[model samples]
Target: MPMRPPFFALSATLVLLLSIPAQACTLWAAAGPDAGGGTLLSKNRDWAPDHVQILKYERPFGGHVFFGLYAEGNNDPGIKNGINEKGLSIVSASASSIPKKMRAHQPGKRGVIRTILSRYASVDELAADADRVFSGARANFYLVSDRSKVLLAEVGLDGKFSYRVVDKGVQTHTNHYLDPKLAEFNVSIGQSSSTRQARINELLTQSPRPFTTEKFAAISRDRNDGPDNSLWRNGKQHTVASWIVHSPASGPQKLRVVLANPDQPEALHEYTLDEAFWKKN
Candidate 1:
């Protein structure tokens, strides 16, 4: 008979396996020349309570860039966030607790994100599709823009997607839903919403100028008051936090992107992607 493995070794193996960290969500910020002089600011996180993986799908649509994000089963070239060849940008965020009355009124469909991108060439165009696209799914917030315009779109859990056009100003968003109509369901109370919001405001206040890709990257990597050296989460504070800024793509063809770990300020990663690089296959 084969000899049995030692008890201590087996115990150690189990402990090691248990010690591995889980795959936490990731946040990213992207800004650059918009095929024109307009600026863009976008912030998004990839989250999962299940084995779902959120991805960006890029393709040519109507001679422009089209992209979207959808659940694994609903993959039909949908886009959660993307910028087209014409420089229009779009993105979405989670918003919980939609009204049942609203939920009952939506039309079911696949690839809603892609549908919005393919049909709408501007923020206004995308806003028009909000209610129809948001029906059936949980609440979600959106940021859509082109070289000359910007809009904040909110889709309630009840399938009501509303638009708040922001023509000229800076905007910031996190995980919570922001709509006066759905304010009763806003669950940000007692959460880290205040803390994270404060931090984002602080960073933006520190850097007030014409938005640039470098400035946008710097905002994304800011982890000033994080409890741990790790930028992933503030365990003591009980919250997962991250930030990003967007600007109209203009000026130099090259732009910088940076990622920083709060625990190790000295170890920062930076990337410079130019128009040519962004256009690569």
Candidate 2:
């Protein structure tokens, strides 16, 4: 059995898993010099109970801020994706079983990603800071993007992580490790990740033109054409909510999003990340 940390000392990351009973999720992003034009990111948050909400935050540093939606009590505020005042956006996908190795204690229980969002001003800084929090006990994937680019940092099972500048068009991650360097430690890579990855490829390939926020949302909602590869799952492990997050390359540079609870698709809520992050007097 997995060893459970004491309640008082439980990391926010650990509490998130225990509190929500969340199973899995799918995160997709597109950016970089080669990305269609600007940035388009999306994700399907597959978890239990389906109780989700959007949250905005302000940093004490005066101008720092960010916004995201997650299960009410989740420590990782950016459950689907979030954008900071600097226009850096982040999204994470849960990779299956990885070799576990505990690391030294770190401050703050808001999970490493939330901590990164609160401190870093750009994608470059986010990646560097995340690199410093490698506990090696978890294998997860994170896609961080700015107006001009996106990067993938796969937190591996080796107390280290790997980075890959996402290619043109779209960058995607399901519930498994895609990098070959750490395949030996991938004992529990989920089967759904491959199915979803293939479906995303087909959808992007069939897109008539470069993706805009609308096109990106369409892909995120894709349920797959064939019987074999379905992107949205409603079985034992299912999609609780779906998110389409986009930040305009220019203008206020605010993060825009369309979030839909699987149980209530037509009731999808659309809001700007700025609205969620800024506080009223």
Most lDDT-accurate candidate? 2
Q: Candidate 1: lDDT of 80?
A: 46
What's model 1's overall lDDT?
0.45
The global C-alpha lDDT for each of the candidates, from Candidate 1 onward, is 0.45, 0.59
Tens digit of per-residue lDDT, candidate 1, span 38-120: 55554523332222323343664455544333444322123445555444566665442322232234455233455556666
Q: Give per-model CA RMSD.
A: 13.2, 7.1
Please give, for residues 1-35, the per-residue lDDT of candidate 2 as tens digits. 68544335646564344332225667777664324
- Give the clashing pairs for model 2: 32-149, 56-276
Q: In model 1, where do residues sit more than 4 Å from their true spots?
A: 1-37, 44-57, 60-64, 67-79, 96-111, 135-137, 188-190, 227-281
TM agreement with the true structure for every prediction: 0.60, 0.74
Q: Return the number of clashes found in candidate 2.
A: 2
* Number of clashes recorded per candidate: 23, 2
